[model samples]
Target: MVCVEEYAVRVLVTGGAGYIGSHVVRSLQGSGHTVAVLDDFSTGSRRRVGADVPVEDGSLLDTAFVEASLRRLSADAVVHIAAKKAVEESVADPLFYYRENVAGMQSVLEAMVSAGTRRLLFSSSAAVYGASATSPVTETSPTDPSSPYGWTKLMCEQMIRDVSLAHGLSWSALRYFNVAGAADPTLADRGESNLIPKVFRAISSGVRPQIYGDTYPTPDGSCLRDYIHVNDVADAHATVLEHMENADLCTVYNIGTGTGTSVFDVMTAVRLVTGVDFECDICPPRPGDPADVVADPAKIRAELGWASQYDLGSAVESAWKAWSDAPS
Candidate 1:
């Protein structure tokens, strides 16, 4: 609650049926904002998208659908969350990643301009700061994305800045760290790019959880990352959305807890929370994995008055509960 009034607006969230998008939509709706979803439904489904939320079943690449939807909803702002986000998948097929993530962003921006939607919150990623030179990455830290997926995010950030330079657009790019868990179990992350879901998938299959590359230079010889709950990520989205509306923002911020959790730390927490003791099988390191990446939220905290409320254990516990309850 940054304002005396809730600062409600008609928001259009792209990819609203997906995992992170769904939670963001929920957060926006809870804050008394009207919301509509535009999704292709390739990886997202109607069930995760609530019946109450209005939806336009279409692709972001299709400028016609995007323009029509923006005009139809008379959206006050747009939160661009639709992108292909898998590191390994991006490595395997870089062209597809570029075509979908980068090209789709272009289409969205064009549509927003066409529909007179000037405010936008772009879903950037910590992957933009690939590997880590500093322990706690600040907004001004050097960006050297090691993977194609990370590169796409960086490109989108540049696009936002360039677009704003040319057009009257107020935009913010929040570079997310690892987003996990859910506000509700039903809305828990279903994607397999993260540690929690991969651990769940492995353990449930009667195999030990696999930790890639235990030889990284870090405490306990494993990579460290900032794991923020999806709900907290969504809350940051709400905060940024309101912040964008109030002021001129052609800037970037890291969306993360100002702390780091190692892979081994997460495994222990998962075992403790699930009460299912399992060993971890250490494999070779992935190509682009950095030793560690933690966020310095000082800038965002002082400016936007935002911080992660949930701890890492709570996030893993919620995901485990959802994984256990759902049919795999």
Candidate 2:
């Protein structure tokens, strides 16, 4: 299903060629929206953005370039998805995260203001919640992020809020959970930083996928996470954009299935989907890792009539097929 709106609007997606960005871009195209892409190609691809789509290759950090692109494309809305996203990498290099995520967001918003683009969809993360006391992290959860990456996301959210207040920009910040799976096989996550891709890499390399920790206090003694498909995430973006037509703006939403899946559970799904009876070894949990991280998507569902379509089995199955078939 395409996410193109009833009224034709020119939308520019920043980092529209990356893992999640590509899915959203395709959804926009399918829905009949006039879409353009602006990506630095740092960890993105021209193909993922679609060969026929208009793509402006440049850095989001360049305010002048971002401003020029928004003006040139006559963008009516901007979906900001370009940023540094690795949790571990952010820990090792907090300065880089601040420089890219926060500063880059500033550039995008300023450009939108310059071009008179009033609508926006900002890519946020569940990392902003850190370790929540509740089972299902809500939109109003305490946002005391433990890692620098989380801090960057939280800071960016604040920046977006401030920008909207000052510029009258209509925006939605979709705080994503453990985003997995693929809408298409070729667009399956190529970066191995994510769990699904990491497991696929291990299996293809003749190594057992390692469970970070099995000693956590959960049903399976492993960390439980809310894994949402890339397709569903894309769908949420489209739905929220539609909702903005005649509703309140500058709101935040948690994007997930509102259910928990353990690392062991995901491993089993990988085995089931791939038809490989592979064993996994348990290792110490990474620092700052929480026992359970789930979502309470009530706000988004009630507001936008959004619900996830893919279950764990379908998501894992599609992901394996994508990873297996995608060029190595």
Candidate 3:
């Protein structure tokens, strides 16, 4: 196995200017690894990236551009974090999700092949496990994606596996649960569809937030999710990269807190953090919705020696602080 400790490692992050991607970039740099960025700036702001980092501004669908950037940087590893992640939006437009998430990943893989970069750390989701009956879904759980977004992530993982088998690529797909909070106020999640942002947006507009469903099988009769902190998610990328470089194997690990928090529970947390007793409307459940989706993080904790540091309240507190500070 090739070790990155023997020499300096340069990692190219595909969506380095985006929310999670930006934090991952900072984490990699802090770990003494040289980092560069490749993003089109469509959804990500250039301000999120450090001015010193060389950024290749282009779409991942453009294989030539990605390959050129990879070759230019001679990156030792590629952290593919670029993708459209809204589940509802994906169900509404499956074709767009396929093109952006699936096809875009293919372009990244093709570019890696051309550039002779063999290491990859994929940004995956628990959505790939769909509506499993398991309380805390394990890495070995049967994958049955419930949405187009989930399907795209599963397909990307499969592609990485195939590429590894055929081309000697070492990879790790960190299947993340609900990612929340911000390392910095400027890095706060600006996503309209994400739950925390949605709640903040509704409160800011003096409107009650909508709770999609209240008839699920869970204790709270709402969707249960493992909301992991973004900083911890960022640290997972760095740790997993180091693991892949030293071990040189293809593997999958769930990146989340083993605990689960329901949608209603999240609203309560928001109220406590923001000191606003906001009401919510229990509306019909959206399509492609799952009841419970938490992570069985034993694999990562035992293998990589990494664990989540923030609890649900801390996630809400940090997220509210950043959300409150963002410009209207």
Against the unseen true structure, what C-alpha lDDT does each candidate score?
0.89, 0.86, 0.91
Separate clash counts for every candidate: 0, 4, 0
Angstrom error at residue 318, model 3: 1.0
lDDT of 3 at 293: 88
- For candidate 1, the per-residue lDDT at 158 reads 93
- The candidates, ranked best first by lDDT, are 3, 1, 2
Candidate 2 vs. true structure, TM-score: 0.96
- Return the top candidate by lDDT: 3
Q: Write the per-residue lDDT of candidate 2 for residues 199-228, one digit (tens) a residue.
A: 988988899888888888899899899999
Model 3 TM: 0.97
Better of 1 and 2 by TM-score: 1
User: How far out, in Å, is residue 101 in model 3?
Assistant: 0.8
User: Can you give the TM-score per candidate against the true fold?
Assistant: 0.97, 0.96, 0.97
Compared with the true structure, the alpha-carbon lDDT of candidate 2 equals 0.86
State the displacement of the C-alpha of residue 234, model 2, in Å, after optimal TM-score superposition.
0.7
- RMSD each, Å: 1.4, 1.6, 2.0
Q: Flag clash pairs in model 1.
A: none
For 190-217, candidate 3 gives per-residue lDDT tens digits of 8878899899989988999999999999
